[model samples]
Target: MRTQVCIIGGGPSGLLLSQLLDRAGIDTVVLERRSRDYVLSRIRAGVLESGTVGMLEKAGIATRAHAEGLPHTGTYLAVQNTGFRIDFDALIGKQVLVYGQTEVTRDLYDAREKADGIVVHELDGVELHDLDTDAPHVTYVKDGTTHRIDCDYVAGCDGFHGPSRQAIPKDVLTEYERVYPFGWLGVMADLPPVSHELIYANHPRGFALASMRSPTRSRYYIQAPVDDPLDKWTDDAFWDEFRRRLPHDSAEALITGPTIEKSIAPLRSYVADPMKWGRLFLVGDAAHIVPPTGAKGLNLAVSDVHYLFEALTSHYRDGDDHGIETYSQTALKRVWNAIRFSWWFTTTMHRFPGQEPFDQAIQDSELRNLQTSVNAQTVFSENYVGMPY
Candidate 1:
């Protein structure tokens, strides 16, 4: 097969890129390493930055999202079970939408199918060749047959574990990473959320967050050891521990239910310099990862897609290469800023293992400042709603 752009990943980023590019008169094909069912079943963050909502609109897939997504003007932050709201609308006149990542991916997939876009699934042994020169192609095995796609450009949206980022030469790629000592043990249930808006809590026991996928489906997380097995925390144990960490009001309002999904996700802040190498450009987790503290992972992926799509469109439609040549530099600027914000938020809200007294005091001071200082809340609101593209 031959195409203008071969997107190596059927996640939201890749699909969004393909959708946008196809509408702009560019032909593209998408490749995925997993079946469509598996991808849709994965649970992920639901917070949508204002910019993400706009991107969904640009892709012409926001009708369902806008109808079902919950808009929040503010969020509650807690320190030792007492909480205060950071009014995002008051601070910046912008708010975030609580829409699940799964829903976004579903929308993208639906759009792709309606538009008859190509997305290959359950491939094996994918490889990239001739990426340094103008003509690049990708190959993978499916159904006991070897398939090849020759394309003008490759968008590596296959994520951190995929072959995209590793295809970059070791000497050329620079990596920065901080793997946190703990992970978020999250549970998804069919019960109503404890609060209408999300609540992020910091307590002596651990950090906990009250979030939701929809009004009827709640998702919650509590900080726990990275290596702890799933069996370590039973349903009763999780609810009890979660209640102990939440504010008295939210805790009292919480409704416990059997979890439909539960897992431990290790936190990490990772970035790769120069998101582009030749015609193969890294997008989303293939290039960077931020802790879920600020719900920036999927949002960052959307931002990366925005940059790359603009660049590719400029190159194709108007015969301009400015955005194409500078895609990495431009995207990384925003990516780094998000990394800093996620790092700061994660540090402030979670109790590190073996943390000294001084560290706890410092975290407490920062939380207090955010609670009482208008300037601090403004900064939080700005970052939470996302910066401009």
Candidate 2:
């Protein structure tokens, strides 16, 4: 098979890139190692940055999202049993959309199918060949048969454990990572949310987040040990711990119910320098990962796709390679900024193990500064809404 671009993953990043390229009259094929059902089953962060929402509009897949997704103008920060709001719209005239990542993937999949875009799933042993050479190709086994795809370029959107990143030679790659001491124990329930907007609480025990998937469906999280087992947390126990971390009023208003889903996700910040390697490029989790405290992971992936899509379009349409030549540098600039923001936000909200009293004081001071200073709130709002792509 031959295509302009061979995408190694069929997740949102890969599918979004494929959809945009297809609309641009570029040929591309997406390969996935799992079934479509498995891919969509995974629950992920729902907060959408302005740039991500706009990109969905550009790809003609925002119809359902805009219709169903809630618009959040701001969020709350709770400290010392009290809460304060940071008005994103008031600060920067922008707001983020509360849309599940699953819904976004579903929309993209529907668009891709309607357009007759190529997506191969459940393939195994996917491999890349001659990535550094002018001619690049991918091979994989499907249904007990081997196949190869020849393309002008390859996009590595298969995520952190995918083969695309491993294809890059070690000598040319530098990786940086920071694993947080705690993980988030998240629960989804079929009940109204405690608040209309999200609330992030810094409690004496740990950190807790009050969020939602929809008006009637709620999502909540509390910081716990990284090695905590799922069986150790029952629905009742989870709710009790969650309520204790919030302000008295919020806790009083909080609705309790049986959880529909629950899981623990460890926090980490990781980045691989130089997202591009010859004809192979990294997108999304293949390139970097940010702690979820700032809700930057999926948004960062969207930004990476934006840079790469522009670069690929320029190369194919106008015979301009400048974007491609500087794809790494351009994307890395934004990637690093998000990484920094996620790290800072995580440090401020979560109580670390063996944390010194001085560190607690600093965290308190930071929150106080944000509460009193418009400049501090503006900076947080801008980063929360997203930096310009």
Candidate 3:
């Protein structure tokens, strides 16, 4: 078979790109190795930037999001048992929504089902055997049989391990990566958010974050040693460590929950330069990944797709390929900015083991400066709400 765009991976980036293109009278096919059920139900980002919300609204996918998503003004940065709010609206005249990634997948799932130009082959794995050739094809097994798909352009939104980037001769692709010594032990709870705004706390023990998924569900995370086993993180252990790190006085009541989900996420930052080659393009986690400190992983993905859609649209309408040609460098500028921010935020907030008193004091002073200095607060607010598109 054939298409105008052959998209690998049916995650948010691939699927959303197809939806946007389809509305523009473009034809595309999405191939995924996971079942529709898995993709739709998977937990993803819970925060949406103002820009992301606008994009969803423009696409007519905001009905449920508007109704179910919780809106918040800003977040809090706490240290030494004291808290200060960084009102996003007060800082940047905007607010963000706390909506789970699962909700977005559901919304996109519904939108794609109603869209005619988009196709997703779930549970059928696609292989990338060649990419430098004029004809790049994805071969996959469907209905217990192998089939090959050909397209004018290919998008590798498959993620870090997908074949999209692997097809780029290793010698040609430059890689930058950083691995943290710790990971986040996060949990989904059956309790209302501890606070109206999220709280990011830095203590001598470690870093802890208090966030929410909805009015009734709370999502929280704490820094744990990278080598810590998943089994070591029990409900009680989470509560104890979280209590020790929180800057608020109502830790006991805030942590009350039945504990719905638990997992460990190692902190890291990665980027691949020149996000496009020939007719192939990359987006979302497939292009870059940021630690959750800045909450840019999902938002960055959305922004990349935003530019990709614009460039692709211009190419189709005016027959001008300039925008598509500059897709990689265009998106990389913003990608690296977020990476730097995530790295800075991660290193500044989380305390490493065997750190000297001077290093810990520096992080503490930085946190204090963000709370006490107006200029510092403004910077945090600008980044928290988001940078200009």
Compute the lDDT for candidate 3: 0.82
User: What's the CA RMSD for each of the models?
Assistant: 0.8, 0.6, 1.6
lDDT (tens digit, per residue) of candidate 1 on 1-389: 99999999998899999999988989999999999999999888999999999999999999999899999999999999999999999999999999999999999999999999999999899999999998899999999999999999999999999999999999999999999999999999999999999999999888999999888999999999989999989999999999999999999999997999899999999999979999999999999999999999999999999999999999998999999899999999999999999999999999998988888889889999999999999999999999999
- Give the worst 10-residue stretch by lDDT in candidate 1: 355-364
The most accurate candidate by lDDT is 2
Clashes of 1: 0
Model 2 lDDT tens row, 1-389: 99999999999999999999999999999999999999999999999999999999999999999999999999999886689999999999999999999999999999999999999999999999999999999999999999999999999999999999999999999999999999999999999999999999988789999999999999999999979989999998898899899988999999999999999999999999879998999999999999889799999999999999999999999999999999999999999999999999999999999988888888888999999999999999999999999
Report lDDT (Cα) of residue 144, candidate 1.
96
Worst 10 residues of 2 by lDDT: 356-365
TM-score of each: 0.99, 0.99, 0.96
Model 3 lDDT per residue over 1-389, tens place: 88888888888778778888888888888888788888876766688888888878766788998999888888887876677788778777888888887787778778989875455555465777556677878788878888888887888899988878877777778889998888998888988888877888888888999998887888899999867887898898898889888875747557474688888888889998779877778888887888899689988988888888899899889998888989998899889888988898898888887888899889888888887888887887777777877
Question: What's the lDDT for candidate 1?
Answer: 0.95
Model 1's TM-score against the true structure = 0.99
Could you give the candidate ranking by lDDT, starting with the highest? 2, 1, 3
Selected candidate, larger lDDT, 1 vs 3: 1
Q: Candidate 2 at residue 327, lDDT?
A: 96
